[model samples]
Target: MMTHIVSKATYRTHMIALFMCLTFLWPCAICLYCTDFSRNVDHYCSFCNAFIGTYE
Candidate 1:
């Protein structure tokens, strides 16, 4: 019984970590890629343009 409870808690912690990574990390990655591509092509993608002067 104690082992089962511990396992559940561990699983919940892992899930929270996964959720945080997906939520926060993916956006930064996308922004970086969008900016890099825009710089190379001399055209700002909509995603990069939308974020301009935002929260800066």
Candidate 2:
């Protein structure tokens, strides 16, 4: 029973780490593909256009 609880906690920690990595790395991935580093008036990349649009 204690081992099961420990395993569950470890699994949750792994998932949290995975989520953090995705949250950080996803923008880096977009920036890597971007040609223009300049930000528009809204402070987003002009080359990529929209953040949501990038996902699509």
Candidate 3:
């Protein structure tokens, strides 16, 4: 019989990496989807057409 085991430290590291990736990617995806590049107007999201913010 063969057995495989994952160490606690390794598991924790993987979990932390996954959480960081999720936190970073989720917002980036939403931003990309909501952003409107067709119109060169105010910085407003296309989905809700809400002004996000100004660059300068």
Candidate 4:
């Protein structure tokens, strides 16, 4: 059996990439959804504000 080894740095990079992808996925999906149905202006604005981590 041939075993492949992954270095710590490579593993760390892959983990960070995966984490970033998952982290942004939800906000982006919500943003796109809000964009599609922008009839509710307040709803869109709130989600966008939440995405940017700011609320006024």
Candidate 5:
């Protein structure tokens, strides 16, 4: 019975770790996607250089 309880706790910990990993990696994936989009926009925009110079 103690082994069974420990097994369940281990399972829960594994799941929590998986969820945390996904939570962290998913935002990085989204940021990369957005970065790609922004790069595309900068490449296409005629006045992008001017805008970046003023803002950044």
Candidate 6:
């Protein structure tokens, strides 16, 4: 009985991790697909962008 419960809990934890990874990465993937970095950099200059662009 305890083993069964543990297995079910483990399965649920794995599913949640999979969902979180997909949710976080899906937007990043879409952004990469839609934008060319050079064009995007000029138009999308937030403070963070300027910092990274200048430093890197």
Q: Pick by lDDT: which candidate is best?
A: 3
**Which residue pairs in candidate 2 have backbone atoms (N, alpha carbon, C) closer than 3 angstroms, thus clashing?**
none
lDDT of 3 at 25: 60
Which consecutive 10 residues in model 1 have the weakest lDDT in total? 1-10
- Residue-by-residue lDDT tens digits, candidate 3, 1-56: 22232222234344545665688765444333344322133355656666565432
Predictions in order: lDDT: 0.36, 0.36, 0.42, 0.36, 0.35, 0.36
Query: Across residues 1-56, which tens digit of lDDT does each residue of candidate 5 receive?
Result: 11111111234344545665688865544444334322222222344333222111
- Which residue ranges in model 6 land beyond 4 Å of their true spot? 1-9, 25-56
Each prediction's RMSD to truth? 21.9, 20.7, 22.3, 21.5, 22.7, 21.3
Record all residue pairs in model 4 with backbone atoms less than 3 Å apart, i.e. clashing.
none
Instruction: Find the 10 residues in a row with the least total lDDT in model 3.
Output: 1-10
Candidate 1 local lDDT, residue 33: 37
Quote the positional error of residue 30 for candidate 3 in Å: 22
Over 4 Å off, model 2: 1-9, 25-56
Model 4, residue 26: C-alpha shift (Å) = 11
lDDT of 2 by residue, 5-54 (tens): 11112343445456656888655444432422322212334455443222
lDDT of 4 by residue, 2-36 (tens): 22322222343445456656887655444433342
- Prediction 6 global C-alpha lDDT: 0.36
Cα error of candidate 1 at position 27, Å: 14
For residue 25, give model 3's deviation from the true position in Å. Answer: 7.1
Task: Give the Cα error of residue 10 in candidate 5, in Å.
Answer: 0.4
Candidate 6 lDDT tens digits, 1-56 = 11111111234344545665688865554444344422222222343333232211
How many steric clashes between backbone atoms does each model show?
0, 0, 0, 0, 0, 0
